[model samples]
Target: MEQDTNQNKVSKADSIRVKLYWRMAVMLLVIIVGILAMLAVIVTQGWSVYKRQSAWALASQKQAVWGLVNDARFKLEEVSNMQTELQVNLDPVFGSYIGAGSDFDQLKDRFGKNKGQFNASLKEIETQIKALRGTNGDFAKLGAAVRRDFNQYDRDTNKLLNAGDSGEDAVPYEQIEQDMVRTKKSLSALKARLDQERKAMGEVKALTIEDMARTLSILVGVIVVVIAALILISMFMIQNFTANMIKPLHESVRHARALAAGDLTRKLNFQPNRIITENSEIGSLCLSLQSMSEHLNAMLRQVDGSTQRVNLTSKEIRTSSR
Candidate 1:
């Protein structure tokens, strides 16, 4: 009984040691998992924010490009309107049929107020239009003619200004009309190219945003799966170790109580019980407990023998006295 009790105590102590290791392992696992989860969340959030910022930047770029295209188109339209007005002014110059006397004066006044803006638009339109026309067979002649017409118009305006005759428009009205028509065609072609570029840019921005969204979603999914897998693996490992450790402790407790109540047949039952032979701490403990159980068993045997001898000696004395 004493042997069993000593073995149970040692077994309980070993079980407690295993339990402590398992608990520490579980705590470490939890800490590691928590840190990993936090890192994943931080990474996901950072990626999400970066994606959103990229999308916003792309949108802003698209807006800026579209604005530029619109501004170019608006300037082209303004040039077209100016060409029309020039064509209207040419009528009186060609036919000598001046209808609205104040119209020419008013046109001159308007031109003076907007001359800088008009000249800048015309310069930009001329450059873009010439580039679109390219180096073709007949474009050279057309280009020469356009330059001559523009120069003549400038010279005539100067002459009229020097003469102080607001009524005398000196532009060759018929030739100017033809030049305006050609220029309008060129402007229209350039506008078409700008429109095409704007469309392409818009498509690129849309595709980029869509791709980013898909990638972000995939990243989020991967993160969630990884985190869940870690949690499950940690739980499984901890549970397996804890169960193995707790079992020995419960058995040792039951056996100890039985031995304390005088059951000598009680034994320390360890599951998957194998002899520990290593020189490690747990192995040493098991060896020590086995030795203690053997010593206790020998002591109990000696006590039993001593008690029997005493009983026999007392009976002999009583018999003699009788």
Candidate 2:
């Protein structure tokens, strides 16, 4: 019976040890999961912030580029409008010079007075044209060629007007027409080119916005997924740990109650499935409990033996007295 009691106590100690290891394992798992979750949250937050900053930077760059393109377009439009006004004024001037007859000198004088204004307008146009040319490579070469032709036409017209005897007949109208046509064609080409550039700038801005948005969205998704996964893992670990700890405690409570009820025949049955690598307070407690149980059982046996001897003595005393 004593051997069985000792075996039961050993079994109970082993069981407590196994439960202790399981509880510790669960706790460690929870801690690891918690750490991983925290790391995921930090990483995801950092990544999201980075993506947003990058997107803002890209947007700023695109805005700057578009601003330049808009400025170029505005300059080109100003030049085109000036050229149209000049063409309108030149038509009547040309007709008057051709039909002036004997009053040609009077007309020529009038033309001379207006010439200053014309020259000023032409200079302004040329300046703006140069600005347009410098803005882009395609516009530069075309604008230079057009300006050269316009200059030649101006020279020819001035020379004809200055000659007193030669009259307006000396003016090469055909050449003027050809130069004007070329100028119009060049202006149209420049306008078209500017429009194309503006369009391209807009498209680039759109693409940049789209790419930035995509990056931000992807980063957000990653962050969410990581956080969710970490949460679930943590919950699972916590639940597992709770079960391990609670089951062992409940069993220990039951065993303790049974022992308290004076059931000396009843003993705790436990199994240790884990090894102890170091001395622990819990290990010492278990060892102490085992020792206490052994001592209690020994004391109980001595009491039983004493009671039997006292009964035997009492019966002998009674027979001698009779």
Candidate 3:
């Protein structure tokens, strides 16, 4: 009755083999999700970096400022050429010798031509000035200053031309020279600003590329760390699963070998083992080994009892014969 009660106390385990398969499936799912997540980040971040590098964003910056820099440069060149031609035409008209002589028609012709060309050049310069004033803040202010100085010089030049070849009331060329000096300084400031802005744009583009590289490097590092962690976890789980499944079978085998050698000792028959209450296939195997040991021990005990009785009866019969 005690043995039967003890047998009833042991609960059977469901198959652990199936649990092992499930664990493998879960690991595979984790790997797949990790891959997909990494791919998603790569695609999204790479596209964002590509756009930032110089696509639509840089194009808009060029349209707003960089293109104007080139335009201003070309216009400045045209202004220089026109100013040189104007100076060349007007230089002789202001000569004292020409005023004292009768080359008056030649002087008039040169003045008229210079005046007409200056008007055309002034129109183009005004357009350029408007663009300069509307763009960069410092650049605009410097351009305005340069324009004012050039205007002073132009006003004096026009006065000298209108009073052509007159020995009397002409502003000294030195006064006009001072205005051009100031104009040169202001134009230098404007050019310096353009150069600075272009340099800044180059630095910004380089920094943007560095930032993109840093962001991608960090992403790659994180992915590698996570994958390495998963691999360690998988190895640990595989080790644990293998131990749990294999150890019990080995213990059961040892018990069976002992029973086969006919060693029906208390250790094999009554000792507790993993087979007693396991919940998996190994548990069933342990239970079978325990049952076989139990039945054999019972049969061996009965045979010993009958053999003792027979020996006692034979001694009694020999005494009766005596």
User: Model 3: per-residue lDDT, tens digit, 200-284?
Assistant: 6666677677869887896888699779978987998788777766676677777878767867753432333332234455565
lDDT value, residue 75 of candidate 1: 52
Error in Å for residue 79 of model 3? 5.2
Clash list (residue pairs), candidate 2: 11-270, 12-270, 14-271, 14-272, 15-270, 15-271
Q: What's the candidate order when arranged by decreasing TM-score?
A: 3, 1, 2
User: Taking the tens digit of each residue's C-alpha lDDT, what string does model 1 give over 1-322?
Assistant: 5654444343443454665666678668866876677677667766766766665554454445344434544654554465467446543544343424457666666544443454455455455444434422233344344445544544544443333345454445455455546544544444454455556656666766776677668667766776787678778766766565455556556756776798654445444432222232344344444454556677788999999999999999999999
In model 3, what is the error at residue 23, expressed in angstroms?
1.2
Per-model lDDT: 0.54, 0.53, 0.61
Worst 10 residues of 2 by lDDT: 271-280
Model 2, 83-202: lDDT tens digits are 344334343454333333565556555544454444454455445445444445565665465456556655665655543345444554566556556655654555565556655655
Instruction: Kindly indicate the candidate among 1 and 3 with the higher TM-score.
Output: 3
